[model samples]
Structure formats: structure tokens, C-alpha cells
Target chain A: MSEHTVRAYDRDLEALDRKISEMGGIAEKMLSDAMDALSTFDVALAQQVVATDQRLDVLQREIEEAAILTIARRQPLAVDLRECIAAIRISGDLERVGDLAKNIARRATELVDEARTLRAIIGLKSMHDLAALQLKEVLDAYAQRDAERARAVWLNDADLDALEDSVFRDLLTFMMEDPRNISFCTHLLFCSKNLERIGDHTTNIAETVVYLASGAPMPTDRPKTRSFGQAEEKP
Target chain B: MSEHTVRAYDRDLEALDRKISEMGGIAEKMLSDAMDALSTFDVALAQQVVATDQRLDVLQREIEEAAILTIARRQPLAVDLRECIAAIRISGDLERVGDLAKNIARRATELVDEARTLRAIIGLKSMHDLAALQLKEVLDAYAQRDAERARAVWLNDADLDALEDSVFRDLLTFMMEDPRNISFCTHLLFCSKNLERIGDHTTNIAETVVYLASGAPMPTDRPKTRSFGQAEEKP
Candidate 1:
């Protein structure tokens, strides 16, 4: 590749990254608003969250098209090619994160008119906070090309998974205590799961970032039987 | 873009599709076994599910390498390039589906000794059946270059989403009725959500197939809001 073409490809990649980051920013805000909507029962904010998802959808298409164009025109090799591919995949992940946040906001809207408080909201809040933090860290890792930071985010996904388990259990307790809360609590449960999944997708992006930077796959350890054997460990 | 090179590219794409089909077959079997593990509470089956995921991982890398090599060597243009790109993405989705199935099996192992019979299992089974069917349909669509079938699969995803909502509610009811069952119920809930996500990823692959076959971008619809609005209808 000529220097000019390489420069053009770099510029294209940087622009695509910026677009993904912008989508991430919107998704992060959506998550925060969804949580706030849940806490305050703000139906209007929840609606806004749902409406703004179209923007993420548009951005997803735009970034994907840009990546495709870059590949077609530049024929990027090795790391450059991986970076382009990762950018496209990361955009898909970010778009799904936006969708999950929208799901949470929609659930919050559902609870707007309910007369009773759902105990599951507390767990939802914890999940929301953890997912948002992971989103921010993973995006930062991508921007700085810090493979170590990306790996850290990948490892930290287990923390979110554990929290999700705790949240689900607490939600279950609420439902068991009062059958009346089943419908609302169930919505909260789905919302919490969506948030946890958003964290997982962000971790996927972090892993992709690490892979792009290192050209090495992430290590996989078999889940130890002892971990599942101990019932007292609490998630 | 000589005729000879075109034929070579076509041959390579066909070979890549065959490999992906083989991987998909293994993934579908893994999903079925994981569900079997859930139904029977068989820890051994769950362990086997986890062990087999490594094969999917290796297959993912192999397919990726093959796709990359074809792109580098064949230098396919336009629609051909898109097909190659889609092959890489669909393989990634297939691999993740395998991982999700392994996750379900892991959860089954966790709940193996639990005494309570969660009602959500029925709903989960329905979802598993539907997802596996959709995956098979999408793979068929890919093999036949059937854009219409791919679109049908896209439309079918909403049904899975509705089933997911029902399962979420049922699981919440189980959890709320007894805190003692919370741990087992939570694991089941996660497994169901994983199945739902696998369905979603399958839908994504279907969309990509449509795009590849038609050389047109797939449409992005607004997220389904009916489930969210269901909570308000109860009053």
C-alpha cells in the first residue's frame, strides 16, 4: 500500500472509531436515563430513550458502510484489516447495547402507573451502574489502543455476571413474597438481564480490541466444577 | 476479474459455506444437548456441553483464517466480497451460539441438585425449540441463497421475543414464591435469556444472509414495544 493510501485508510478507521464512540456515548446516556426513569418512574424519559434508539440504528449502518468501503478501497492487510473488521463488529455490539438500554427504559415506562414499588429496582440499579462503567472503560481502552486495559475489562465481565445472578435471586425473592408483583418484577428481571447482556457485549468489544491489537485470541479456562459445587459462595 | 478467477472464488465460497454448515450442525447439536441437560438435570451432559465448545472456538478461527485468505488471494469485488465478509460474520455468530449453549449447560449443572421444579422450564423449552428451528432455517436460507426465507426468519424473531417475555414472567413467579428456589431459578432465568439472545443472533445472521444474497442492506426495524406496553394493560 502506498503511503497516501495507508494514510487514507488510517483516516477512515479513525473516523469509523469516532462514530462508534459517539454511538457508545448515546448508549451510555440511554442507560443512565433508563435507570433514572426506573428510579423516578419518569415515563416521558423512558419514551425519549426508546425514540433515540433510531439514531443509534442509523449510526450503526453508517459505520458499517464506512468499514465496508474502507475494506473495498484499501484492501487493508493484517492489523489494518483486523482493525476494520473489529470496528464493524464493535459497532454491532454498541448498537445492541443501545437496544438493551431501550428495553430497560421501556420496562421503566411500564412501571410508571403501578401502585407498588418493586424490590427488583435496587438490583436493576446495581446492574445498570456496573454495565455503564464497563461501557465507558471498554470504549476508553479502544480509543487508547490499550490491550491490557481491554483485557482487564474482559476479566471484569465476570463481576457483572455475578451481580446479575444476585439481582435475579433478589428479584425472585420479591416475586415469591408477593404474587401481585410478578408481572412488574418480571419486566424488571428482563431489563436487568438486558443490562447484564449490554455489559457482556461491551466486554466482547474489549476482547475484539485486544485481539486486533495483539492478533492473539483470548485465553479460555474451563469452568471449574468446584465453582458450581459450592452453594454457599453466593454467585 | 477473469472468468477463471471468478470460478476459483466461487469454489472457495462454496467450500467456506460447507465448513460453516458443518460448524452449524455441531452448534445445533450442542444446543439440543444443553437443553437435554436442563430437562434431565444431568451434570454429565452439561460437562460434555462445556467441553465441546472448544471445538466451536477452533472452528471459528479456522473459518476466519480461510475467509481472510480468500479475501487476500481472490480479491473478490462487490457482491463476492460481501458474501465473503458475511461468511466471516455468520461464523462468528455461530460460534457465539455455541458459547451460549455451553452457558446454558453450565447453569444446568448449577441447578442439578435443586429440588424445586421451575415452571419456566416449559417456556424455555418452547424457546429452545423455536430458536433451533430458526437457526436451521437461516442456515438453509444461506445454502440456497434464499433471500425471501431469510426475511421470513427476520420476521419470526418477534415471536421469540414474546416467548422470552412470557418465560421471564413465569420465572419471576417461581422466584417470588420462595426465596429458597432463588438460586436455581436465577440460573434458569439466565439460561432462558441466553437462548433468547441466541435467537436474536440467528436473526442477525439471517439479515446478513439477505444482504449478501440481494446485495442490498438489510432494513432495521424499531424494537418491539408490545411487551413493554403489556405492563400498562393490566390496569
Candidate 2:
């Protein structure tokens, strides 16, 4: 490291790390709150989740700007360069996580007056729980710079895919059982998809963390369980 | 620009740009081919699109790494810094476009044996054409560094959103009209969503182009219609 790069560059990176952590915290809360809103059909909380997404977007922009500025100003090399790029990637993931959570909340608002399909939601609930846990653990892995932890999160994503497949089948079965369930189940299908994508963001973040820690790219293909129609790759 | 930054750095930027154009070409073909696959129920074409996505993914990683390396080696400032950053951002958008196209193709394979709903696909065809046009135009905007052209693409995205709303309503009507239509219509729903997301990626690329050319970020929100549950935010 250059002598000129010590204090100021460290501060810049620390600020970025702090901002990512903040983004992660808000994303996690928004996810859980959105799920809560969905299960209970709370429009207020759902709207809150939507509103929170703006903050996440703002943070994502800020992080990207900061990272670019740091790279330009400090001219970091090797690991430091990786760190900046990883920050951009992770912030992007977190912002998408926020968006996915907001989507779930939006679906909740749409389903407010519909008949409750509690049974259909059970599979989604499991998905939500696992995705939420993955988000939390992945963020922790980032915070700790724990590549192994990130790898674990990466490995567990296949489980989320499995859950999504189950949710897909359940929602389809519900739609088949009663024509009235079509609209509601379609919204639920999107909700399950949103959750699955959130799981994906966590996986993306995990890969970034592993790269940041090891300075090596992870394998190109992740472990995905669902056989066909990979639920909408990133964004 | 720094005295040290002229020759090699320009070559780096050119390489990045060429890779982006290559990626864009693959992505555009994948999108049109996927739509063709969907309309014709061509399983072989769908498989080809799926296989093409791996190439896009590899190109994305390469572009990202090249951008970072250029940033570190050249320590580009001002417009040059923005160029590298824009390349990274635009590559990401293109990669997602490829994935969405792959997703559309995947859905097509799933629907191969099912009874065709040519009527339901009409709106989707319109969407695919528009999204394909948007992708092409936005990429031209990037190549020419024409912010005005980029802005025009950004403004047109709302029309795509309107199209998605129409498609959604049509698919839902189909599902409601015949219980047998549920499975097919649901796949169409996802395909429409995938197209809408491709539009969003174009919007993202447009914004990146505007920033790269003008050194100013676009407004945080683009013009989007269709009130609830905005399609999955960028991955």
C-alpha cells in the first residue's frame, strides 16, 4: 500500500462497509416486514416496505459513487481494487433485495381483499424464512469477511430453489382446484418468485464476499436445484 | 487525462467497449430467438438460447474484471473514470437481458407440449418487439454516446410497462376462462415479466450512457405506469 493511501483510503472503505451494513439491515427488516404484511394482509406495512426501498436505492447509488470516487482518488491495487468492486456488487444485490421485499409487500396490498389462501402461503412462508436467514447470514459473512460463511450461504441457496419449486407446485395446484384462486395464486406465485430472487441476491452477495476475501472468482455456475425455468436470473 | 494514461488506457477502454458490443449482439439474438422459440414452440431454439446464456455470463465477468483492471492501472479521472464505470454498469444490464431472454426460452421449452394459446401470445409479441427495439436503440445510444437518444429510450419504457399491464390482464382472463389454460397462461405471465425486465435493463443502460456522456446521473425514478408491484428490480 502507498503511504498516501493509508488513513484516507481506509476511511473511505470503512464508510462504504458501514453503508453496506446499513443497507443490509434495512433490507432484512423490509423483508421480514413484507412477509408479515403478506401473511396478515397489512397494507400499511406493505406500503412501508415500498417506501423503504427508496432509501435502499439511495444508499446503492451512494455506495457506487463512493466506490468509484475511491478508486479514482486512491488508485487501489489488487485486494483493495477487489474490495471496491465487491462493494458495488454487494450494494447492488442489497438494493435488489430491498426491491424484492417491496414486491412481496406490493403483492400483499393487491391481495388485501381476496380470500385468504393460508395453505398456499405456507410454502411461501418457508421460503421467506429461509431467504431471510440467508440474507442475514450472508450479510454477517460480509461483515466478518468470512469466505467460509459466505460459501455456506452459497451452498444453502439450492434449498431455497427447492422451496420455490414446492411453492410453485402448491400455487399451481391451488389455481387448478378452484378457478377463483387463480388471481390470488398468481400473485402468490410472484411472491414466491420474489422470495426466490432474494435468495439469489444473498447468493450473489456470498460470491462477492468470497471473492473479496480470497481475491478469486467463484465457480461460474452456482448450485441450483430446480431443473427448468430458472426463476428470472438477477433483476 | 494524465500523461501516463493515454495509449494503453484507451486500448483497455476500446477492448471493454468491443466486449460490450459482442455481449449486446449475443443478448439481442438470444432475445429474438427466444421470442421466436416461444411463438413457434421450438424446443431446439429454446435450448440454444439457454446454452447461449453461459457465453453472456462469461463476457459479463470478463468485462467487469477488465474495467477494474483499467481503473487500477490507469487511475483514470473525470470522463475516463466514468467510462470504465459505465462499461461495468452497461455490461451488467446486458448480461441480465441475456438471462431474461434465456428465461423466456426456458418457459417456451416448458410449454412445448401444451396446447398453444396464440391469442395470449399476441400482447407478448408486441412486448418482445418493443423490448428488442429498446435494447437495440439503447445500445446504439451507448455506442454513439448520445445522451438524447438514451433519454428517448428512457422515456419510452413506460410504454413497455403499459404493454406488460395489458399482457397481464389478457393472461389472467385466459386462465379464468379455462382451467386448462392456467398452466400455459402462467408461463406466459412470466415471459411477459421477463420482457418487461428487459425493458428495464435498457432503461438502466440509457441512464448509464447519459451519465457516461454528461457526467451527471439521471433522476432516481423513471416514468413507470402500472400502479402496483413493479416488475422485479434489477438483479
DockQ, all models: 0.29, 0.55
- As for model 2, its CA RMSD to the true structure in angstroms is 1.8
Give the per-residue lDDT of model 1 (tens digit) for A67-87.
Answer: 777776777788888887788
Estimate the lDDT of model 1: 0.78
- Every model's TM-score: 0.86, 0.96
Ten-residue segment with the worst summed lDDT in candidate 2 chain A?
A226-235
CAPRI level of candidate 2:
medium
Candidate 2 overall lDDT versus native: 0.88
DockQ winner among the candidates?
2
lDDT tens readout by residue for model 2, B149-195 = 99999999989988888889888889889888888888899999889
List of clashing residue pairs for candidate 2: A234-B235, A235-B234, A235-B235
Give the per-residue Cα lDDT of candidate 2 at A51: 86
Q: For residues B165-191, what per-residue lDDT tens digits would candidate 1 score against the true structure?
A: 787767766766765656566667667
Query: What lDDT does the true structure give each of the candidates?
Result: 0.78, 0.88
